[model samples]
Each structure stands twice: as C-alpha cells, then as structure tokens.
Target: MDKIVLLPDLAKQDNFYQENYLLFLRRKLRAAKIPCQLYLINENTSDNESFVAINNLTDTYYLFDQILGINTLSNPLFLADLKIPTDLIPNFQDSRTDSVTFWQGEQRVLTVKLNKFGWVRQVVSYQSDCFIQDNYDVRGFKITTEYFDKYTSQVLKKEWFNNYGELIMTQQNSSIVIAANQRKRFRQATYNSELEIVKEFLLQHVDDKTLFIADTDPDTINLRLTLPEQFRFCFLITDSATVPVGQNIGRFHNIKYAFRTVSLRDDFLQIAPEVKQEDCQLITPVIEKANLSLSNKLVAKIIYWHTGEILPALIKDYLNQLLTIMSEQKDVELVIDATEVLQAVILQQLNLLIKDAGEKTKPAPINTPAVVNRVSCQTLAFQEEKKLMRQARIYLDTGTKSNFTLQLEALQAGIPQFARQSNGLITPEVNGDLVADNGALPEQLSLFLRSLDKWNNSVIENTRIIEQMKPSQVVEQWRELL
Candidate 1:
C-alpha cells in the first residue's frame, strides 16, 4: 500500500473542543482506503494515547517534538510527587477534575492544571496574586519552567529541559542565557526553530514512497521549496487565504496542488499566472449528500454567523429584517447560529427590538394570535446544524465575511442559502440567492416562504450543486492526483 503523510498546521491543546479541520481531511482520506498518516510540528501536551482518544486517529501519526526525545514519557505526572510546600494544602474550589488550587491558610499560594490524562500540565506559585514561578510540562514530563520577577511579576528566567531531565537550555530577558548540548545522546543535530527541526527530520526520515500532502502553512510552503526535488509533494488548498502568492508552482517537478473549489483555483490563478492549469485539481473533502426533502411546515429560517467577527450592531440589523419578515409571515421563525457569547447578545438585542416594536403598536385583542417570541438561538454542531438547515425555509448569510464551511453545510443539507453577493460559494440563481440590499432581504425570503414550489426547486438545485462534491466523486479526484 502507498503511504501518504499529511503535514497539517500546528495542533493546539484545545483542539479537542474545537472543530479540527485537519482531522476532517484525515478521516476523509482514510475512508477512501488511503494509507494516511498525520505529522505534527508543534509540542502538544496530549500524549499519543490521549491525543488519539480525543481525535480518533489510528496508530499512524508522528509528533516532531516527541520523536526528538523530548516529552517522551507516557506515565502520569502526579502532583504529590513534586512535594508541595507544607504550609499550602489542597483546596477544592471548583468541581473540575482538570484543575486544582493550593492555599496557605487564608492566602492563595499555588495552582496546578492537568490534562485529561491526569498529567500535571502547569504548576504556578503566586505571592499576593502575583505570579512567582510557572512550570510547564508535556506528556507527564517537565519541559520548561519560568521564574518571574518578584516586584514586577514579569518573566525573568526560563529553563528548558529534555526527556532525561537535563536543563539543556535557558533564557533570561528574552535571550538565551545558558544553552548547550541540546541534542545530547540522541540525534546529533541541533536546530533553532521547531520548523527547521521538523524540516530536517522529514528530509532524514521520509523515503521516495512517501507522498506528502501538506497544508499551505508558511512553514510547509518553505519546506516545499527547501526539500529535495526528488520528493513528491501535494498541497491541499482549502480557500483563497492559503494560496501562495507570486510563486510558479508549475516549475517544481513532482509537485501538484488540490483545491476544494473552482473559485479558489480561479483566485489562485489570478495571483500565480505562471502556475499551469494542469498542475491543479478540484477535490473537495467528503461532503455527506443530503436528500432533498422539504418539511411539511416551514417553522425556522436559519442564519449562520459563525466564521466572522461577531458584531452586535450587524446582528441587530439582521434581526430587524427577520422581525419584519416574521410580522408578515406568522409561520416563519428566526434561528440564529452563533457561539454562546454571541447568542446572548443576539437574544438581548432581539428581545429589545421586539419590545420596542410592541410598544409602538397598539395592544392586540385577546382573540387575535397570541404574541409569540419568534426569535431563537441555535448551535452550529454538525447534526444540529444539518437538522436546522434542512428544516429552514431559507438560510440568511448576514455576516460580513464569507463562511465556506457553513456554505458547504447548507448545500449538504439541501437548503436555499441567501447571500449578499455571489462569491466562490454562491451562484446567483443556482445553489443560493444574492440579495445585496438589506431592504430586499425580507422581500426575497418572504417570496420563498409563500411559494413552496419555488423553495423546493431551490432545494433540488442544491442536490445538483452537492453532486459534484460528494464523497465518491472526491475520492476519485484524490485517486487521480495520487
């Protein structure tokens, strides 16, 4: 079987709670029966077992820091073994198992944070709410510890360690104070940055059989140019932001690029005119095809606002438009898709708007339809968002920035999406609508709500759009590139 190594951007410790984009690509490739392996370039606190448990990755991944004989310990690092000061006792302030605090009678002294693997992540000592020392660990092994200035509470000194508990590196006042024998007893080479270290490791370890698929991060882009020409490389371009500027990709031998959409490829070509059209292929990650089934009654009109910055004024403007639509259409309801913080603000604004509108108009009689709060908040989780999209009469794109993920999700859910202007994700009358003016948005949405046949036609059109990016079609595209 052929091996394909995926070089994604640095993995964060909080990746377990967030949407891991790299994990999506890895799963899609594996689903196609491709032998895929993930390679990390950063020092994540989670060990192999803990990382795989959360990420659902198999036994085919490598971490550069771990492979370099740093933070290689698999055992749990107990806080008791460190022997905390006798004066300070454990204080169970919070119910969280991953965090703990130690108090010296009435004064808070020390705090310790742990990973899900029960490994001590950081030990911080505080004097009168000012940090004195901060010791950080990776995978149950101490890696770096920083001492702060007592009076200023600024980082004064930092000590770096190896797997063997050796203080091989230290820094003071933003400069290396004591550093030597960094690669002692393991590999002979010593590097300045982690990127250089990973680049060297790849050159030394990967064979000709290894097909490298790297995200278009700056380090990986540099690696693409610096690596030996004989090595085969393919870049996964997810959007226009990742496209390299002013570089002739066609000049590189045994190198190709895979884009998720034609709009992205067109954007890339505008910048890198020298890039050959043949060197790039449109290959979307697996998008689960949704059946075009309309709801018997349209109750919700979803507006996804996850990708861009959350502005209350903008959200208020969108809600005002929705409120207008709701006033005329009784069955339609507003469902906002945003984070928890944004949700609170949106709900507050919507309530205020509804209240103001009620105050302006005369009180309704008892016999009329009881006043109903039509505005509600929704989540952007996969299944929940898919459900909301399918049940929605129309998806309103209200954010300033274009959200490619939500666009794909709406298409996969067989929903009609309304955007301000047609971009790479939206085609005027095909997959979604383009209502440039806010005044026209309510009118367009109201039209769709009144005409079930028109809405069903839009949903059917979504199937045609999604057919080009289905899992089977994407797998075949990958097969051709590989």
Candidate 2:
C-alpha cells in the first residue's frame, strides 16, 4: 500500500534514547516497499488524535529500539529546528478507571493515563500495522546496476557510457528534467571489458554454472538504524525468484536479471508453451508445505542479529524482551551459569577465530571457513538453554521458591564457574562496525562480566560470572580474527 507511517518513539528509560524504533520501522518498510508518511514524534505521542482517526489502517509497525545504546537527539538538523515550547507542554496524571473528572457538563473520564513524557491520553483505540521484527533478507539480484542498464554494472547516471556498447538505461528519470532538479549524474566508467567477460561466462557455462558476483560484500550486516528511520532507494532486478506465498519482504535495487540459457531456437520453442495451466495448478497445491517452512519473522530476526557481529547488542536486547514475554512461563528459566558451557564452546572453537585470522596475511581478511563453522549458533543457544533448564530443575526440587530474591540466590548457588581462563585478547571483527571494536573482554554483553583483576584468585565468584566469562572468550576469539 502506498501510504505514510506515523511512528512514535516508544521507550521508557532513565538515560539516553535513540531512533532505533524509527530505524527498525524504516528497514521493514524499505524491504517491503510499503510506502507511508513518516511522522517522527518526539514527546508528542499523546496528542490522542495521532492514535485516533486511525483510518485506512493497513499495519502499524511498532519497533522496540532499546538494547543498543544510541543518542536519539544527536542530529544537528533536529537540534536546530525542534523546540520545547512551554505552552504546548502537557500536564499528566494517572488515569484511574471510573474517575469522576469532568471536562464539560456531560463528559466524564473513562479511560486515560498520563505517560512518562507528560502526554495526555483519551479514548485509547489503536490499530497496528503488522509488527515485523526486522529485515535480514538481502536475497535478490544485486546487479552491476548503478551503471549500464543497471542490470550488470555500477555506472554513474549521466556523464557518458556512450562508448560502452549497449546502454540499457541512462539517467535516473525517463523525462527530460532540468539539471538543477536532477540529483544523480549519468556516468559509468565501463569500456566494455566488464560486459565482455560476463557475456563470455554466460555463453560458456550457461547450462551448468551459477555466477555470484557482488559489487559489495554481503557478509557484513548494516545496523546504523539507531538514527535515521527511513531508507531512500534506487533499484532494478534481472530475474525473478519466487518469494513464498504470504510473506512480506522489502525492496531492492538493480532487480532486472538475465536468463543464462534461453534461446530462440526451434528446440527451445518446442518446450516453451508445452506446460498448460492445468499442469501449473497441479503443482501449486503441493507448494504449501514449503511455504509454511519459510518464516518472515525468523528471516528478519536473524538478519538484525548477524549484522552487527558475533555478539550484537540488539540480540541481547531482543533476548531480554523475549524473556519478558516468556516471563509467565513457569518452565523457562532465563538465567544460566553461562561460564562452563561458554568456555567449552569457545575452547572448542578458539583455534579457529583467533589462530586463523592472523595466520594468513592477505591485505584484506579472508573468510576462514574453519572458524566460521566451529560451532553452529543453534548449538550455543541450546547449550545455554539446557544449562538454565538444569538449574531451574534444582530450584524446583526445593519447593519452587516464589520469592524473586530467593530465586536469584538459588540461581547464584547453582551458577557454574568456568575452569578455563585467559588474559583475554580479541579480534576487531567481533562487533562488525570496525571502529566500535574494543579488545577489552569481547561481546557487547561482556562488559557486564567478572573482572579478573578484582578477584583475589581465591574468592569464589557468583555463578553469573561464569555466564559472563565464556561468551566473552568466544567473542575475544572472534575479535582476534577480526
């Protein structure tokens, strides 16, 4: 649907905030091509009218942007134009149900609450657009599109590719817009050698090969969304791969694709129209099983988590939220003595992340497959869960204490201390955003771990210390490779 989305900043904390909510929303929108008006709300969520008149309701994407630390008001443009006018500032109060507060002669307050930002709420009726977690699906043709026809190359929009044989598309627009209005220049530095190579490859191996060439590496994840909430894009595609039915994915650039082996020969023509609609419907019915296995939510979550690095701050935040959601479940214990399992996992894989990254001296980092496949992420996650389960069982055996503090004590007593230790050193690639790399400890959550310097070496540490240590070890190993 071609529409604008009005997203309000939804967070409550004691410190700084960010536009992560907005970034999360924009990523989903960009991937889905669900265009909408972006009303970036400040402390103004309680206009009530914003949530009111919620007509043409498609879906309201609510992104929870806490976990990773980011400054929400860091933009200079917003600092210049936005203001805190005292007159518009609202006075808030707790909305008690059946409160006898009158506005006029007939109006009696039914349901309304004063939120943290001093905003007023009245007649709260909300309609949410489908809430998608995030977009990690980068699947689609990434053409050398910026240049020649954008199907095969990264060319400037206008300066001149006239000498480069086939000009599929020239400028950004089809019309003759004046130079002042135009934002992109038509210029691609192709002398036909690039195309010559591709054509040769297609002709030689058309029947049996797959060529995966990307202008940019696809391994690194993009997580700069804590600020700007919208994605501006230019795109094209060359081939169409079927997106499973009932799934929502975002847009792409350079979408046009080429068929490797289709020709205008009589043999090809003989098979072209052979398959009838009757045959198509017969196979369509069987695709439901495959469609159910493809999950949009999983695609989004994995993308966001993997983008930052081995231990993304977004993931810890996500896990915390998951725990909150699952808090009522009596069986699922959130805390685990992460040390022993983590140490086992890291020790199991350290030979790969640390030893191999520096072993080879190519100017750019090469993909160390041995390190990458050391342990499947699923295994680590399950190990942590199993440890938590084992401890929770011990706690349950003692009459399943209901007190929160007592439960924490039970958890601490059960927390396993990791046996392996090292004066930690990590690779820079641990956090993906190369500059944010810190060799100290490792994972984003590692900062909250046991301090070896603080311990006298003889004192027993809390069980959570072990939880904090081993993940850091794995993180450090990855950092070493980075």
Candidate 3:
C-alpha cells in the first residue's frame, strides 16, 4: 500500500501546527483507517508529545532529530531528571515568554524556559564564572549545550549531542561540523545548508510507493528542485497569498498536483491562466458540525469578529455602532475571536473609545434597576469561541484579508456573516452580506438587526450552503485524492 507522508513547513512551539492541514490530513487518514505519516523536517526541541497527546497521534511519526541515532535510547529525559539545584520543586510559571526562574537559597542558580507545550524548552545554569544553557528535544534529551563567557555574556561555542549523550555536532562562529553514522560507519561532514543533511536523510526513505504532500513553502520549493525528478510530490496550498501559481508548474518534473480548497483552487487558476485547472485538486477542510440542538439560545445577541490584525479605527467604528445599537436595545455584545495578545490590545483601545463615547452618549433606560455600560465586548479562546458561535446572531469580517477558516466556521454555525471581501461562502442578501462600502455598515447592520425574519431566513440558507463542505464529504474527497 502507498502511504501518504505529511510534511509541514515547521513544527515549532506556538506555530499553530495544530491547525495545519498536514495534521488535518493525518487525522482524516486515521479515521478512514488509511496509513499516514507526519514527517517533521525542522528541529523541534519542545515536548511534541503534548501535541501528539492533544491530537491523539500516538502511532507513526518521524522527527528529524530522533531518526539519526536517538531511536534506540529507551529512557526519555524529563525536567525532573535534570534536578536543578532548587530548595523547592518549582511549578512551571504561566509566562508569555515561556521562561521561569529558580533559586538556590539567595543565589539565582537556574532559569528554565518552557515551550508552548508546557515542557522544558531550555535550561540555563548560572555559575560563578559562566552560564551554560542546554536545549532539549521532545525526547527529553539535550540536543545542544552552549557555554557563555560570564564576563562578556557571549556564547563561546555550542556542542550538539545525540539522545544517548554522544557528541555528534559542534558549531563555532560560521563553522559547523556534523558527525553522521551510516550502517555503523562513522564520518564527519561539513554542509553549507541543513537542507543538504535533510536531502541525505530523505534519500534513504524516498521510494516509488511513498507519496509526499508538503506545504508550499520556500524550504519545500527548494527541496523539490534539489531532489531527484522521479519522486512524486504534491503542494498543499493553505493560503494563496504565499504561493505563486505559474512558477512551480514546469519548474519541477515530479510535482504531480496541488491540493487546495475549492475557493483557493479557483483563485489560483484565476490569477495564473498559464496553470491548468486540473493541476489544483479541490480538497475542502473537514469542519465539525456544531450541534445547535444542545446549544443554549443567547438572551443577548453576539457579533463574532475573526478579523486578523485589527486596526483600532476599524474596531472603534464597530464599537460605536454596537454601543448605539445597545443603547437602543440592550441585548447585544461584541465577541472578538483572536489571540490573547491581540485581544488585550483591542480591549485597551476599545476602553479609551468607550470612555470618550460614554461621556457624550446617554445610557438607554431599561427595566433593570442596576446601571449597565452601553458598550459590551469580550474575547474568547477558539474552543469557547466555537461554543459562542452557535448563538452568534451576526459575524463581522471586515479585515483586508479573508479568513477562510473563520468564514467556514461562521457558515457552519449558521450566523449571518458580513465580509469586506467576498468568497464562495459569502452570498449577498442570501446567506450573508458583502460590505462594499464601510460607511454603509451602520444602516445595513441596523436593517439586519431590526428584521428577525431576515436573520432566521439567512440561518436556514447557511444550513443549505454548508452541506457541500461537510467532514464526511471532505474525507471522501481525500480518499479520492490519495
């Protein structure tokens, strides 16, 4: 049987590897009982087992560092094994920078940084003369250890080690020496780029039966050009913004097809007429169906926002409109679905706007005795956001770039969506509205808010629209593609 191999751009901490199509493909393949392997190219030091645990991926996986010689090391290294000189066993601190400090009595002895996976990323030991930092892999073994001059606080040299604590590589200045063992034969090699090392490793694995589906990144592009022309490969197009259409077609003889969503496929073909339509396969994502039956109907309305890198001016307008709408009718809230950092920034800007607007705008009289703010907004994580989307009356997408995933989520949730730009999901006055002019948002939004019948009709239409991109249908498409 021909096994599908998923190659991601990179598998670093907080890179949203969870949301990548490579894992998505693996998951679908797993459900269908088809053989698939996630081949990681990048050097990931974090505890990737956390990622594997979260995704239920315990079977076939190939890590770049583990493949070389660490495969035989039975005992995995953990933070506990390091046994940093500390009075108390310290808990991993909730840190945005992914670091924590430890003290041995008065002297600060050690500092440990964690990856987003909450595993020990790097451990730095403070000595009287110098500080040494150790970088570990997911296997809980040190990959690299660097010595720094305590006086200058500059790196002296880095020693790379295999999982069994064998010195395999070293780096000083611009020089790097790799000690590779093939068939129990040891040899030292100097390479200009790590891609050379990767090519050598991949050469041992590449066969006629294996299918490599990789992200269309620069690294993969370079790899495709470097590799033998006989190997079959596919470019998984996640976003069209990054991928150039006409360039890759005849550049490599082995690139069999490009996999993308229906909308992305059309967009790709439209941009580059030189590229054939059949070259890009339509493989829509598997979006889980929201169980609306068990969901509670919101007493207050919600405006879900998935616009990435939100401008303060754009948000202020939405807040002003939301506040005005709230003053007239108190049952409304704005939910900005974004990262924690972005959420904080948006809230800080909105607070200033609310303070200024609150002075001028009078609070609307309601039946409740207690006073309430006219402007109401909050942010939720993706999991909570998923639940919130079930009760969302309207979804606002006014960013310059179209967020296809969020658009699909809104479509699945049966929310009346509005977008600055249009995609296959957005149908003006049918399932959702298109915001051609930002100035007309107030009137258009007000019309939708006033008409309950129109809102319900759109929700019904959204149900019909989302049928084409169901998970089962998408998995079937994958079965066909594979």
Best by TM-score: 3
Model 2 bad stretches (over 4 Å):
1-44, 47-109, 123-246, 250-482
- Over the stretch 1-482, how does candidate 1's per-residue lDDT look in tens digits? 56788777643221212344555666777887776788765544443333534342453445545443563546657667677878878976454657788987887777887666666767878755357554444446666677776687677766666666777656565444334455553353444444555566666667877888877777777777777788888887776567654264546778788876676787777877777888888765455656543553544444443424547777666666666666766666666777777777776765655565567563422112222365667556656765666666667766554555566666666666776534445666555677554566677676667776776777777777666767678667778988
Q: Residues 98-119, candidate 3, lDDT per residue (tens digit)?
A: 6777765577778887766566
Candidate topping lDDT: 3
RMSD score of candidate 2 (Å) = 26.1
Poorest lDDT segment (10 consecutive residues) of candidate 1: 363-372
On the 0 to 100 scale, the lDDT of residue 468 in model 2 is 47
Ranking by TM-score: 3, 1, 2
- Quality of model 1 by C-alpha lDDT: 0.63
* Candidate 3 global lDDT: 0.64
Question: Would you estimate the TM-scores of all the predictions?
Answer: 0.71, 0.18, 0.75
**Per-residue lDDT over 320-425 for candidate 2, one digit per residue giving the tens place of the 0 to 100 score:** 3323322322222223222344435433443443455567642222224332332223322433433333233122111111122222222233321211111111
Q: Residue 61 deviation, candidate 3, in Å?
A: 4.2
List the candidate numbers ranked by lDDT, top first.
3, 1, 2
